[model samples]
Target: MECAGYIDGAFVKGEGARFDVLDPSDESVVAQVTGVSAAQADAAIGAARRAFDSGAWSGLTMKARAAAMTRFGEAMRKRADWLSACAVKEAGCPVSSTVMGAQVHAPLRMTDEIVDLFLRLPEQEANPLPMHERVNPHFAVQSLKRWSPLGVVSAISAYNVPFYTAFWKVVPALMAGDTVILRPNPLTPLSSMIFAEAAVEAGLPPGVMNVIVEPGLAGGLAMTTDPRVDMVSFTGSCAVGASVAAQAAPTLKRLVLELGGKSAQIYLPDAVGRAASAALSVCTSHAGQGCVLGTRVFVPQERKAEVLEGMAALLATVRIGPAGDPATQLGPVISAAQRDRCAHFTRAAVEAGGRVVCGGKRPEGLDQGFYWEPTVLDLPDNSNPAAQEEIFGPVVGVIGYRDLDHAVEMANDSRFGLSGWVHGADRVKALEVGLKIRSGAVNVNGAVMSSYASGGGIKMSGLGRERGIDGLREFQMVTTLTIGG
Candidate 1:
């Protein structure tokens, strides 16, 4: 079926060209998704602005707004099956990974399990600050602080975790009472289209939420640079994110960017084989297309052989095949280009004196799809490009550290600092080492990116937070008022 863009209140045939959405498992054509012209993206931005300005949505009472959000959550839950199918086929997310990851923490399916959490989220701070005491009897002064919605938000979601990332941007901003224009990554946009269905079913104001799937250079540029946009929330690569921030800077629009990560996992001298197993399992999850996947592993130099053996064993057990299969734990990367990326980085690292411990070649039988075997490389130094850069593939590079101090230093010695993981025998020791590293979320012995707290990074990993109170605040503007008699 031909899938068109959802703008304002209905699905429309875009004036721009159309592109084929492919199934990564075998490079088969799943469906056709049409693109919207730059003018169409601007129209979306205009709709959001008009809705916010008209008070059609922003002026709603908190109770009414919350009720709509709850209905949206319920509607999304009803369409969870379609979400699961799209997640596996088009995006190559592991079916089991969507079906309650047995190896990882929490179900990342973005289904009923997660929507309920969004529905039950605590109310935003309506009046965060109290008014000061009266100054005098006749001349009394009152001060009030109010959190108001940002006029309009432009949300650009990433391809890797399109539904999950896009949901975070949409739901919180909607709950904060801001109108949104969501431009889903052209490569993996079906899920967001489904999300728009939920919004419509929940009876959101016609222009309150809009979704567009178009080439990034045109649609994304138009959305980010338009003057009607009050804020831009983006999730993608650092290079693209930098450009988005620069364009929005001139307009002084608020931005929440969740960019790339070369996050590391430090397994101390007392590191258990379980940690190595966890690292291997994660690299295979979503075909290692995750931004927070610990692609770089740091272990005490003495335990390299042990960790390598454990990783090889764990990876051997992973079933890399069609994402449609429920038993399949590892699926193909998103596209042939992504598959090539995995091969190029691994080949480049191997030529630079890195040792390929296991699984670096493309699968011989599975030549139809973008399938490369899980790769584990042993880096001679911490500065190897593969160890320092974000590969966004199923390739794990292992770097050895001298000691605790050395481990911390090496973990923090990257241009990126989105997330980190440290596994040690002593709880206090692990916490200390985890604390020393530069990251938004640090896990002691697991790789869990939870929605319970704020998540984002320092330095180049992108600015602002996305999943907690900070996330809600990102969509709001604060104002103070004083009255005197």
Candidate 2:
């Protein structure tokens, strides 16, 4: 199949070179994409700029925008199967693991919430400047806070869960009346292309939503540095995200970067027994390409041996095979480069006096694809490369902690503070432990993250939130209008 970039209201076959999209399951060509040139990228940004300035989309009433978003969402639902299938082939995600959850369903549900929040936003609200009043009591002044849409946005998404990341960035920005040009990673561009089709089906005005595909960084650099683009919402690695920030600095564009994470999973004394089984959450799903998966597991020093044993037993039952297999619990990594990167990290850990309890290499029967076994490394300390680096593969590094304090200390020691997990029988203690961890979101005892709450990281993990009211505000600008008396 052939895929083209979507610009303005139509799909265009660019003048740039063609690149092949490979299926990681067997390293076969699933589709070929025509890359967008720098000129085409600038055209996309110009289209969004025109749409925003002309009020073709941004001038609509909140109700009309919400209704259009509803239609767009329904259109996406119609293509869920196609999107899921494309993602499985391009990303090597298992059919049964992330297909229905992150790839298709979750984004739809999130859209509903974003629409509701967008409707609830007050166009203008009264605010009393109490500090100013106290300082100058001679003159009375009344203030009103106004919420308005930021102009054009350049939404760049990662390839791990392509459609979901695009939806998470695009939907909220659109709902807040910001026109967007979505740029998906070239390796997995098929699913994101659906957004353009859905935009047309939903009757959105031209240039309100655009999708661009390119194999190199030039298109992304154009989006980040273009003066017409008002904001940039990006999701990728820390190194690339930093580069993006630096590029956008000269333009002074509003930025929402959801970057890397070396998150930790802490097992309280009472919940040490469950530590082994929890490894499935990281290893089994999409081969741990998820940015927030707790790859560093902190367990009690005394129960280290037991945890490793249980982990080995549980992982042994995981079915690792082709991504299309319904019974596959774990799939291949994104590509050959990713598989080799995982191996390099594991080897570094071993060289630093660590031992591999299981799965430091490829599976026995899977030689055709870029498959890496679900690995677990028993590290000598938290300083090991396997424990500290974001491997972006199905590998977990187990580090022994002296106690709860030591565990919290070790968890906060990392520069990346994205997500954390705590397992404990006592709810109060678990909550306390979660509070102490210096991360954005913390889950206790298998509780899932709420869509209503904001999701983002602190420190190096990321700069801004991605969901709920706070996420909506990320796409909006706040102005305080004062009435002088």
Which has the greatest lDDT? 2
| Deviation from native of the Cα of residue 38 in model 1, angstroms | 2.3
The parts of candidate 1 lying over 4 Å away from their true place are: 1-3, 98-140, 447-449
Q: Model 1 over residues 235-330: C-alpha lDDT tens digits?
A: 999999999999998898998999999988888777656556755666667888888888888887888888888888888887878988878877
List where candidate 2 sits over 4 angstroms from the true fold.
Answer: 1-3, 131-140
lDDT tens digits by residue: candidate 2, 59-144 = 99989999999999889889878987987899888899954588777886777778888888788998866876724767767788
Backbone Cα, N, C clashes tallied per candidate: 0, 0
Residue 296 of model 1, lDDT score: 85
**Quality of model 2 by C-alpha lDDT:** 0.88
Residue 458 in candidate 2, Cα distance off native in Å: 1.2
TM-score of each: 0.92, 0.97
